[model samples]
Target: MSSPRLWLVGCGNMGGAMLRQWVASGVVAPDRIDIVNRGDRDFPGGVRQARDLPDGDLPDMVMLAMKPQQIDDIAARYGERLAGVPVLISILAGVEEAALAKRFRTGAIVRAMPNLPVGIGKGVVGLYSESADAAARDQVAALMTPLGLVEWIDDDALFNVLTAVAGSGPAFLYRFIDALAAAGATLGLPADQAERLAVATVQGSALLAAAADVSPAILADRVASPGGSTREGLNILDREDALKTLLVETIRASVRRNAEMAAAARQSAVGLGRITLFPFVLSLSHRPSSPRTGTRRTALRQAQGERQGGSSSRNRTKRLSWCRNGANSDCLEGAAMVPLYP
Candidate 1:
């Protein structure tokens, strides 16, 4: 099948990388792609580049590869022109599909998180879309196939987690490699030689793990003899699961930052009237009384009083509580008394 006509809004690092791979892999012809950027830059042969979008029929796909903060400016400028575009793919981090849909009218909007390795077609692309139909999804999957490992996220909430892991994982791995080299250098080895050895060791190990049928944990066991130097090193890393804990904390930090960005994007879309609501349900672990009428009566009275007194205003806080059954010990087990919007 012929490749879709693609208009890339930004030809910076990530976008340019994907563009190069698409052209080199024959997934997209240079003539079929157009790139719009603030200034001229190198691109694959036959590809068109311009400071402004060309005047022609809308392309089959419009990719927003610019920074997330530029979403408003870009949408305001091209929203009308790009209305009803078949597929809108955004590589802007932290920008959710809802935010994009609110700004631009499109048949489908896909949020893609691709790392830097996509330049060499060995990256991980995490994609999430709620508006895409089956065909649109297939087109996106096909486009990313040449880039690297493409994963479709079913839950939008987990997109940030994926961004933390696959999208930002390369840099983390690079840091680990650097640390390994530094440790080796500290042990009296030549710094340059240690760096080279560290890089090669990590590369070979990763390749082996990928080709092995067993999990990485099992492969790690195969590398360490029953009572050898490797075992000593492994003990240090595995002590109280130190390495695992450190990684978990690191990824969690990334997840939190991604969530902040997403919130900022949503706030930008909604303007100053945005109010974030966090819903939490408080359930009593133990029964208040002997599951008789005493606990049920008191709980119901308090809930009724709160409901009657509460105001349905954004400024006012609301509370609710209730009993599930009057005769059971778990009567007041679950009582959802969450704050409601005005």
Candidate 2:
């Protein structure tokens, strides 16, 4: 099937990675993808990037790849324009479907949790959608196919657990790799060589585990002789299921945090006014003292236009000067807002 036209909001680290893979794999043509980001990025040829949403009709799908905290801000800026999009896919961690639905109108709201490795087509993408029909689900699955293993989560809570596990799994594994290398170095091996060996060992072992029919436990046992160094090492990790216990606690902590973030996202409506000032406030931080004749002034004017619906002489002169001096709580008057950086 042909790929759907995709409009991406906030092409940061994870989003940029997915874009690179999609373009390279020919799953989605670069020309068919539109990205709205805070600034320019070196994306594939034919892909368009701009500070604001493109003009004209919406695409078949819209994916939110920005920071989870910016959800309200994005909705405020583009919610009307995005009304009735076929599918709205969000990769923001901890934000739920209901939160998205409350902010914007869409046919289906899908929450996708993807790890960093999706850039290499080896990541796992966990999808969950309560309102989408089978056809919509299938369409989403097909689009995510080139990214990696795509699994549809049955329950919302389970989806959160999956995010804690798969989405955060890569970082935990990196720690283990680093520890393994450090252990080798402690045993007097050259540090650089130890790291190289440790990395390769992990890479080869993961590939083998994936291909093996037997479980990882069986593979470990198969490697360890009745009386050997491997067996001795296994005994330590196996004592009282220490490794498993540690990992369970780690993931449990992550799950709790995800829930907290979800709650915050749901209640973020109260902060929409403050969130709307983010882009303009961010621009102020990098701008020169004199915002006389640059994009900085243009951005300020744009923010004023967005907030107050056109800039007046008084707004352009007095308020603009006040903001250029530096954005503070007083700039907006009675609105407890600060610059994006502060």
Candidate 3:
């Protein structure tokens, strides 16, 4: 395949890390990449950096790496310039593929979600695209392979939820590591020593889990003897399934917010007011998982209220189910898609 001319806007932290990995891995030479930012921003040692979309011909591929909140400015300012590009990849959170199609008349738009670990070629990227064909899909996948395990999400709506899990999941895990270290320090270990051990311990454990042929549950069992220290801590977490409950709410919060983002992206598609997820009684057995009480009526009233006020919110029927006896027991995946208006 011929290497496509690349254009990047807002190559900061998350985006910068992806680009840095691309360059370091020798997937693309320094000179082949072009960066466009607000100012004359400094970049990795190599690669061409431009103040604006290079004046003349459009690039073959244009990617947006700015924040989701900045999508409006990004769409308004640079959208037209990159229109009709063969591929437009967005790393912005919450922005949907349909939104990209409207902003930039691209052949295809792919949402590429990457975490910080991509810098050292140890990241996991979740990709989604409803419009791209087989070849186009392969191209995107190939580009991401060097970074880490790349999976293409077949359903678009699931993007946000998956993004919530994979994209935001790292920060949650990192915080766990930090909390563990701090707890160690609180128990009398030196802070500096505690931090090092905590980080290394997590890294090693993660590697072991990833490499192990057995499941994590089995692995945990192997670590805890008939009556040991690991078992003591395990008891605390296992009591009434405390950890699972805590994580359920944690994941629920992220998924709920992702729906909010879908609303945001849809709002941008049309010049309508913001879209938000009304906390409605979302009963999976029914739909919208609303609480069992009078809260459902209140949420519905608020949704109606928004429409009357010129903004509209819809409870895109969300249904969740569990079948432990099926394929993967503890594994929970979601499907989230927002219909696009022409």
Candidate maximizing lDDT: 2
Candidate 3: worst-modelled 10 consecutive residues by lDDT: 323-332
- Report, for every candidate in turn, its global Cα lDDT versus the true structure: 0.74, 0.75, 0.67
Model 1, residue 153: what's the lDDT?
95
What's the ranking of the predictions by lDDT, best on top? 2, 1, 3
True lDDT of residue 178, candidate 2: 95
TM-score of each: 0.79, 0.79, 0.79
Superposed on all Cα atoms, model 1 deviates from the true structure by an RMSD in Å of: 11.0
lDDT of 3 by residue, 1-342 (tens): 555567888888887888888878777666778897777666677677766777877766777887666677777887777777887888877666766676677888888888788888888899998888888788788778878879888766567557767888888898988999999999999999999999999999989998999998999899998789999999998998888766665665455445445445655344322332223322212223322223223223322332334333222321112212221111112222222111
Error of 1 at 187 (Å): 1.0
lDDT of 2 by residue, 1-342 (tens): 676799999998899988898888898989899999989999999999998988888898899998887887899999999999999999988777988999989999999998888899988899999988998898888888788899999977666678878998999899999999999999999999999999999999999999999999999999999899999999999998989777766665455445435544555474333343434433343332221223223333434343453323333344446555653212332112422210
Ten residues in a row with the worst lDDT in model 1? 333-342
